[model samples]
Target chain A: MQGVEQGVLDLDEDVNRYLDDSEVTVPETYEEPVTLRHLGTHTAGFESAIDPDVVADWDAIVPLETVLVDQMPPRVRPPGELVGYSNYGAALAGHIVAEAHDTTFEEYVQSEIFEPLNMTHSTFAQPVPDDSPGNIAAGHTRDGDGFQTVDTVYINMRPAGSMTATARDLAAFMRVHLGAGTVDNRRVLQTDTVRVMHDQHHVRHPAVTNWRYGFHEYGHPDAGVLGHSGATVHFSSHLVLVPASDVGIFVNYNSNSSEHPPPGTVIDEILAVCGLQSSSTEPTPTAQPGSRERAETVAGGYSLSSLPQSGPLQVIDVLEHVSVEPAAQNRLRTVTLAGNTRQWVETDPYVYHEVDGNDVLAFEVRDGEVERMYMASEPTGVYQPVPAHERQLVTGSILGVSLAGFGLSLAGWGRQCARQTWKQYRTETDSVTEGEHTE
Target chain B: MTDHSESIHSQQSGHPAEHIESDERTRSLTWLARVAGVTLSTVSLGFVLLLLVVIESGGELTLITRPFLMQVVLTLPYLIGFLTVGTTAGAVLAWWHRYWSRRVRIHHTLLAVLGLGFSWQLVRLGFITL
Candidate 1:
């Protein structure tokens, strides 16, 4: 905490420290440079390796610095390479905070962040206080017999998972981010710094797609959504915010039933109730059960021999080359030869099942037999399909860049009138750039 | 002869009525006991299953061991509730079936309670070992 307060442990400094000591040994001096930002954002490439003995009491155990130092190794990746989810990185950051403040990690967080935010109900401890108000929902699992308690897990990883807080308290934490780093007039982080944290820092591996800083970046940069999800042995929780819409959501569940709604359900439902349209209007097909007419209509076999053998095929292949077997009323077992996966196709007529971003296929019966297909031109990639509007925007951006380059060359003639004319043309052509500058 | 014959008939009729009432009470108690037992067993089982799912569904598995498990056992009251309700129902049923058999009722009640308590404790401990 002191290092961060003293501005001695900046993001780049921490990254450099990790990179320098990544292969061999970490110097003692490098330890003080780690901070909460590095851990929370996973900028520090700390290894996940942990000692078995210490992990035994993971939930309640508070390991001394010596134990942690002896057990875990330095970061695996180079500093600032990309955000790869690292719990050990967060642990090291916690250690740095503890050392800097001359107090425990729990104490520093309690005094610095928790108390200031008025998150009185939150605690970084095991065995929540008996007198704590609000219901501590009992965690349960659904087995063949029924729901049972799970009694395993250590408390030693408290910095990473020992947090216990009410929904309201979590909401308050969200409010801090939503309010631009200030909660109840107390600034936990600078507004610009919080914005930086929310910005896309690194793209996680396997595919250079999802941006990872401390966690997965939610929603597009323009869409203004940010959050993280935390799952424990018997519970799952999420905290999210849509800053542009001035909205925030928090959800926690103790049951392991897939029947329970997904994490974003509450937020989506709330947005729907408010009659707000999502920034992204891409249609998503949801699977439902027990609808007769639609199921019978879409139930049939489909084939697509027109598709190219390899590389990227046209959207037509995705739409036409599919088969559906009626499972129940309203539900049809969809078979796509391309992906080779069985998907539950919904029966909603207006809402077409999305085979890909632009392509929406409907399984309908034309005559006596069930075989009808619909296709649309669309782009395909591992990442979410770029919207048509976004594609147009990209094109416009490229055009604007070309135009700006031309104007810059024209202005190099060193004529005052020519420069003014070029500036006006540039401003007119790229209003977006000018608007961003004004903001 | 008339007095002896009348007394014999009355004894035969009363014996069947007593048997029917005892049978009805035993059936009622047994049904109650079964409901309680299944409810408790299902809940405990569910708790364990939920933990597994949480761990499998991207939860940190290392968090569910030892001191943490012990803390959950102590703080969470659901396990205790399940055992108490299940055992009490079993005890009441045993009493109903063996109304005259005090020893049998006590033995069954104790056994049911002990079995449930032991199972709960064992599951709690097993999570750590596993």
Candidate 2:
């Protein structure tokens, strides 16, 4: 965005135009070039593995260009089609920013965005550089009995995840976005640029959650709640900007334990105490006519489009299939392999609201068949129908049956080997006695 | 005695332990066949069982979401390919060799066949590429 404000990069221009080498490997069939806007909106259609294969050891980390060219994930879908949250796309956009300024991405951001915003504690440098102020928090994992401290791994694609900052600094950053790129009378961005960014860039559906330039619509669609959530294996952070209320919140946690409350929980309480969020009393509307019939139309297994559509990680899609089952009284139940069950009630045609929650389940129906399903809270990606063969029941059954066959065969082989050994021993003993008598 | 000892050593070295347990088992299978069979039964099964343990313990849904476990899962195909090829050859040898009892022969053949079928399941599940 800083690059866009300075005219160093154009939002609509193809990202490949900024690359001196290592262009994004779009499929031969896909003619549409992935633009900077697509990267920002996460509509670049990259079917990447959840991991970009970041290096574990800091020393093993390579240059961004090397990872981009050598380990570039294949583009399996057409650009501007699906909203698949992509770290690679974010990293690519950062690379373009660096290229435009003839400097490293870290240096460019340091000079342009971070320093100007006075985010002194944040740095893209790996290991946070020895001299940087403030100690980095150690992340933790939930062990059997308690939490165990874990090392923070290096993110090779620095632009994607490598940043060390406190909630205070992030709140300062958020204030700028909320204050129209001005915080404390220091203008960090042009008013128009800020307005353009806050506006919806790409929308999955007007009725469902949509993506702004970088933030996803959260809470209520019109509550003006836009937030971006970031997580690694151990640590998770969430930043929300309620532009309408001129309120913003930033929460960072060092642990992602099930016992630990989600960042949203903290944010919600803060919002509630401040008299901002009053969603608890929002009365549930009466079920619209034809709700059950509409629910039946969208019932089936769905795979998140953000998940890998090809490669070994594709099995993750198989294991994590989300099934939508029609329930009693025009309610729909969404069940996940993770064993989460969310019930939604239809309040509008093809649009369902959580029975007692804030999330919305809106489906796009075409020709009486569901084409896409959108969850308001999961603004990063949308779900598409899973094919019959890829469904969990089918794959899980095959795996179970196969294991049984191998196990039974193995047991039989063991029995046969044991029986043969005993018989051979007896035969040898009898032959030895007969030979002794002859001698 | 020296010549006799040399002859014995020569025989031992020249032929594999022959019984189904040793080279004499050459009548049934070679050492390669044993290793492949053991790996197909134990190694592959061990991995799947470990996966099941992880899943039953609530790792199934979270496995895909976590990057570390996924890195381990994606590396299985390269390692499992050896078993796939070996089991294929082992199945062929079990069918061709006629020395063992009918049941034993069928046991080896059945294991090989089942192992191949398990590999197919892995492929269908997208763990192994077709």
Best by lDDT: 2
Error of 1 at A86 (Å): 1.6
Give the per-residue lDDT of model 1 (tens digit) for A1-439: 2354467556545433533323223444443444345456554545333222234343445464544555565445444433334545566666665655667778888888888988888887556667766766677776566776665444454466567888888888888778888887888877776676667655332211234345454433223456676665566676666777778878777764253665656655665576442433434444544355566655555433223212111222233344556664344455554455443435254224333222234433456443334322110111112223223233335334433432442343237567799999998879988788999
Worst 10 residues of 2 chain A by lDDT: A20-29
Task: Tell me, by TM-score, which candidate is best.
Answer: 2
A38-66 per-residue lDDT for model 2 (tens digits) = 99899987765666555556887777777
TM-score of 1: 0.46
Q: Between which residue pairs do clashes occur in model 2?
A: B16-B23, B17-B22, B17-B23, B17-B24, B18-B22, B18-B23, B18-B24, B18-B25, B19-B24, B19-B25
Candidate 2, residue A413: lDDT: 66
State the lDDT of candidate 2 residue by residue for B2-83, as single tens digits: 9899779867765333333454556345556756766677767777766666566543333543446555645665566677
- Superposed by TM-score, candidate 1 places the C-alpha of residue A37 at a distance from the truth, in angstroms, of 6.2
Q: Give the candidate number with the greatest DockQ.
A: 2
